[model samples]
Target chain A: MSSKHIVVIPGDGIGAEITAEALRVSQSAAKKCGFSFTHESKQAGGAAIDAYGVPLPEDTIEACRKADGVLLGAVGGPKWDNVAPELRAEKAILGLRKSLGLYANLRPIKVFPALAAQSPLKPEIVSEVDILIVRELNGGIYYGARQEAVIVNEVEQAWDREGYSRPEIERILRLACRSAIGRKGKVTSVDKANVLATSRLWRKVANEVAADFTQVEINHMYVDNCAMQLVLNPGSFDVLVTGNLFGDILSDEAAVLSGSIGLLPSASLGDGTGLYEPIHGSAPDIAGLGLANPLGTILSAAMMFRYSLGSEQVAAMIEAAVDQVLADGYRTPDIYQQGLTKVSTEEMGQQVINRLK
Target chain B: MSSKHIVVIPGDGIGAEITAEALRVSQSAAKKCGFSFTHESKQAGGAAIDAYGVPLPEDTIEACRKADGVLLGAVGGPKWDNVAPELRAEKAILGLRKSLGLYANLRPIKVFPALAAQSPLKPEIVSEVDILIVRELNGGIYYGARQEAVIVNEVEQAWDREGYSRPEIERILRLACRSAIGRKGKVTSVDKANVLATSRLWRKVANEVAADFTQVEINHMYVDNCAMQLVLNPGSFDVLVTGNLFGDILSDEAAVLSGSIGLLPSASLGDGTGLYEPIHGSAPDIAGLGLANPLGTILSAAMMFRYSLGSEQVAAMIEAAVDQVLADGYRTPDIYQQGLTKVSTEEMGQQVINRLK
Candidate 1:
């Protein structure tokens, strides 16, 4: 049996609770697939900032670097609200993404058949909604320069710089196109090319690289229209590629369209090891109350299996288990109903594991 | 009876077709309301570009400036695909916005109970979907500079700049706040304040302005999370105030949630004269086919009456006519299905006009 080492980061709030659930589910799937997995727990985010005075400890990064894969529960909470925004819990996640050179943030929006009613959109419109939004994670305006609040003639002066380099745009675009080719053989490169010059470059590069994927149908939609189309007709899209700023907004919109943010998993990958996490943030209000949904975290574990550990069968088994659990009417509070039984984080994890058996 | 000069610039593609419908409906509504509106036809957009080699002609701008109100059908088409992007037909519309100082772009997303079935979201989720998205039209990353593809050592280089000033942020925020005060009295300011300095300033200024609206509940949401929330729980939002970039993307999304982009209208107001236009672009593909949906353009006419002419009653009459028409089960091809009464552009216009009587 092949053995893979995975780093588990239970950052803050519901992080610790969901991290345990994901690990338990992963262990069961790994054993069934004839693989042995070793888990190393580490402190990062708000928890690390509290314990080590640094959001991301040096030792934690080193351990993650040496690991075959990483599974994160969630990060940030009001507990870190008093902390300087830069040294806040989110900084650790951003730092990991930057240091790991995790250029592509792949968020898959899938409307599982069982939870389709939870979507705010018409059931017919979102029933089988499946879209992969490849967002450029580490670049664009997120890391751009700052001018905080400037006082000119007693009035505040505020400015922020938004700039992007060629290499940054190209790499994200190439990865998005390659991912698109692997799926529906179609790619829609979105940008505000008419007004933004950076978007024009994005348009040009996307077209240039699209030529490389002759088998894939390459299309372009303005970022504004793309947002509208996602609500109007989501099924028309398969793979979406865009700049970092746009990806951040569009992917979140796509996530909610999938019915529950708690049901989606995301993978941020680059030059080093992959970091798998749920698209949803840690809900401090619901943390440790057993009310937090762990399905997103478990799904992240499945992604780690398929992408990092090279265990497609194990990943599929884990996915089937999740579907079966939902099909059997087990619901988390976030998606709970009166008649349908609501299960806690631990119970949901156990239910999936039992179904896997 | 007071007579208002209304500039009707039916730019290109189905713009001309739709504007003709708007003229008939507006003239009929004006007559019924005992008001007189002199409609002046002018050329703009791709049609203007083709005939006069200029998207925004001096005469056209002058007509809009002199008129009491301006009603645009739609602009832009692929016919000018090879043309310099700036000189394209869309620029005339954008240029009109800049010249007119149209800063606040108000897009209302209202799901009609009659056509709710056309929405992809479950009818229950979309039934009462009514939101007003106040987009800052003039500033943000939209006007940012860009250095197109550059070659250095056989490698390409590209850079785009996104910059915003304090006053620009303050003015737009104030406009958004004032607009919110009239509606459901809730303002959700969306920005990237945590990451970008411009957002920090935007947040600071918006907070200060929000303090003035004592009755309105003001909340802040990041642009990404705001987009997701828009889909996840549509009812939670009433009026959303966002920057130019976020507004451009979100307004389109909100429009589609209502079932048809064909039923949307937008108004852009700045320091000078306001411009009203349909959110749907000129569909040259359906140009002479008479298949264009004119409701958006007609609704734009209603917005013109309310904002520029300051006649909310006339606007309400037009809106009521529209609502009743939909209630009567009249559907255009874009929204029509079997068993529904389908109407053409002219028939739809006449139907609304007849209802006004």
Candidate 2:
């Protein structure tokens, strides 16, 4: 038996409602697998602003530091739109990522068989697709040298640099290789290597990293062609590793393939404690209505088990429970279909817990 | 009647055959509309390399500068893949765009009612979609400062700068507004404002440019969200404008929306002279055969009439005739369905010319 300590930050809006169900499901899974789980809830984003007048509180970071892993629901809303730039809810995410050194973000995209009918693509094109995009989260153009709104000779110009050190490329590529160790053992490094110097460097370092894992097959694709292939034939890709700029766009493009963005989970990992979260944002419009989908947060907890707690069997059990529930036609308001059993956020959580093997 | 002198560079492979059909259609349209048409053929790409050992010759640039506009068929093939990088087919495009000052790249994506079934997207989502992407061609990371493969401390690094001058942003936004003026008068400026300094500056300058054209409805979208929306709801957009790097990705993503990529045409415009070309590459395997699709080049000719020759009526006539031919079930090898009447490249061109109003 194993014991795990986790920090849960349900930041604003529907985050709390959906997060509650994830926690409940996690507890049930822990009991079924003979593992011990402990968690403490914390406030950030708008909730922190309302109470402590700051987007990220020191205590929240402190708790995360002391924990083995962190699970965040969602953050930001219309209420924090006009807040001072420094106190904005979105900053909480940037702050946490920076503070925790979360350099690699893992976004796994899969198309459930039962849910294939809901996809925008023809069923045959998207019926079987599983791709994990490993993005270098905390570096690249986003953190590079930048000049915004500078006037020279009364003319305004803007510039941003895209740079990647050897270590940054190595770390993310290594994480992707580790992910490949669990999957089909194929990695496609996407970049515009022929053009951008950063992408060229990215490709070189990726190849160097690939040399370390001889069992894993690695190839390269340009960012633009990767975008096209995602729609043309999504199943061909296994693991896609890229720098921040290209990953930000490609990951989002891959997310929409399933038409189940509300039910997808993501994990951000570093050399330290990792963070897991749903890919969807905080839907403040439906905060207290119980209409939010809990499956994403629930799946995030599953990812937490596999990546953070090192329990692959437990994670598979949780995911199979979800697949079973979805196959059985029980859905929340977000993924509701005609004749399917409709459940509230809490009810969906309970259903998954009940189905846990 | 105004006389338009243009240069036609039928680069390599199937380019010569496709260019012949487009020119024949252009001449028929000119005769029907009482406008004078004249063109000079020039060597470029593989053709120029075979003839003069250079991809883009100085004489060709001089001829293009003397013409009112330029029309180029597809360029590049595996035949030139091993040639010196500087003597490659791609340089011909770059050289022409730079020499002609073609800064605005216009890519129009439309889902033909007849071909909606061919889209990867379900018919309801992709049908009736018409979007125009106005991309600034001459600026941003593609033209930025670049450092490739610098080794330090026994590690390799690379960097690229994304810089946007005020005038570059203003010119592209102004062109987008002008495009909007001819369409629905709505423009969605895409950028990564939250992360990249260039995007933030792009947004700021775009807003300043928007104020001048008060009647045009302009909005902003991040590059990632724009990628999602391209698949989720392509019909909701009209005109999308952005910098070179973002445009390169987004435009290609948008290109695949219609699933009839072989039939799409693109235009690059500037103050001096505009260039029109088929978005498809030269297919050497199908070169000199009667099987290649010529509609993209024909439509490119139509764009030349409107954007370069200042003959919107001729352009509309050409487009409607192509629509008529397609609706009548005439198909080329690229777009042929089981029951449609199959036609060769020249026959399809003739059918459209016969249907011209």
Candidate 3:
């Protein structure tokens, strides 16, 4: 049997409780698939700040770099809200991404059939929304050089640069095309080509990268139109790929379509070790209350199995069990409907375990 | 009587038909309000390309500059799709904005109660969505300096600059605060302050500018969160102000929530002349047919009356008649429901004219 080593960072707030359940599920899924994995706990975010005087301790980074993959719970809370800008709790995740060289952030917005009624969109529209947004993480304006407010021509001004290289665009687009091949074989490369020079270059490179994957059909859409389409006709998209800034905006917009944001999972990937986490923030208000949902974290672990552990079967098994658990009418308090069986975080994980075959 | 001089540009495709109806509605509304305005027709867009070898002729620019306000129908069609980049029909609008120094673009996303059912969102969510987006049109990445693809460090790269000065931020924020005074007296300034330097400057300047308006309440939101909030709770926003790029995306996203893009109107304003138009595009396919909707163009004219033509009463009168027309179950082809009385482009304009009191 092939064995994998993983680092689990239960960062802050409800992180400890939710991540414990995710670990149990991962173990059970791995056992059922006749594979094995070893994971060790590491502290980051507010927890690390309290333990090591830094949001991202060198010890944690070393462990993550050597591990096959990392599973993180949400980070940051009011407790660390006033920390120095460099020592901010949220910096842990950013630091980990930079150290690990994670370049792409993948957000899969899937509305389960049982939870379709919870969507803000009309039922028919929400029912068919299964989009995977591939966001280039390491480049673009978010990480580009910037100027602080300074006097120029007797007026205070500030600026930021948005740039992309052919290599950067090619890699992300290639990943998007590869991702589409496993799904509906459609990729929508979104940019502001009509207005921005960077977007024009991105579009050109996207076309070239997509050509390598003949099975995948690729199209380009302006960011503005894509924003509207995500709400109006979300079912039409399979994979959406864009630069960091556009991705940051569109992914959040797409996540809310399902209405229950607590149930969405995300994965950040690069050439080496990948990072998996729920797209939601640390719900400190509900920390340790047994009311927080564990599905997103559990799903993140599933993504870890498929993308990093090289266990597609275990991934599919875990996902199928999650689908069955929801179909069996088990819900966490956050997603609880009046007539359904409302389960605690531990109970929801166990419910998925019970449904696993 | 205070007589105002206005110029009307009936550009390509459905532009001529819609503008004629809007012009007639303007005349009737002005007559009823006891205000007088003199108007002249000007050519632009593809029409001007054919007549004067340019999308925006010098004659049209001079006429628009001399007028108190300008009303334009939609521009661009397939006929001008292959033109040189600079001579494209769309360039007419850009040129006009530059020549006239229009720095603010106002897009009011008001969902008529009768048409709430048309929204993709649950009726309860979208029904209360009446947001006015005040976009800074002259600056940000769209107008910033850029680099086309070039070999940097032996890799082809492209970049665009996003810069904002204190004066630009102050002017737009002041406009937003003033605009909010007439409505809900609340302004949500959107930016990406946590990540970008420009956004930080914008936030700093926004607070300083908003202090001048005691009647207005202002709050700040990160652009990513704002994008999600637009879908999750659009009704919570009164007047949303932001830089150019973010505004371009959000305004288009907000427009589709009403489900009838054809019924949306827009206005671009500056220190001197202002331009008004519908937010929808010219439907070249349905050009000569009576299927086009004229409410958007008529509403644009009404906006002109309020903002530039100096007649708020006429604006209100036109708006009330529009609401009454919709309430009376009249619908154009694009927004027609099964049980509503379907009216032609011309008849719809007539309906609003008849209801004006």
Query: Candidate 1 residues A1-357, lDDT tens each?
Result: 787899999989899999999999999988877889898999899999899998999999999998889999888888897897678888899888876778888888889889987787767888868898888877677776666777878767665555566677778777777777657888899888777776777788788878887777889999988988888778889889887888988987888877788989999988778999998898998888999899999999998997788888988999999999999999999998778989999999999999884
Cα lDDT, all candidates = 0.84, 0.91, 0.94
In candidate 2, position A328 carries an lDDT of 93
The residue pairs that clash in candidate 3, if any, are: none
Q: Can you rank all candidates by DockQ, best first? A: 3, 2, 1
lDDT of 3 at A316: 94
lDDT per residue for candidate 2 within B283-314, as digits (tens), equals 99999988888999999999999988999988
Docking class of 3: high
How should the candidates be ordered by lDDT, best one leading?
A: 3, 2, 1
TM-scores of all candidate predictions against the true structure: 0.92, 0.98, 0.99
Residue lDDT tens for model 3, B59-149: 9999999999999998999999999999999999999999999999999999999989999988999988989999999999998999998
Once model 3 is optimally superposed onto the true structure by TM-score, how far is the C-alpha of residue B89 displaced, in angstroms?
0.9
Candidate 2 RMSD to the correct structure: 1.2
Give chain A TM for each model in order. Answer: 0.93, 0.98, 0.99
- Candidate 2 lDDT, A197-242, residue by residue in tens: 8888888889999999977999999998888889888999999999
Compare the candidates by DockQ and give the number of the best one.
3
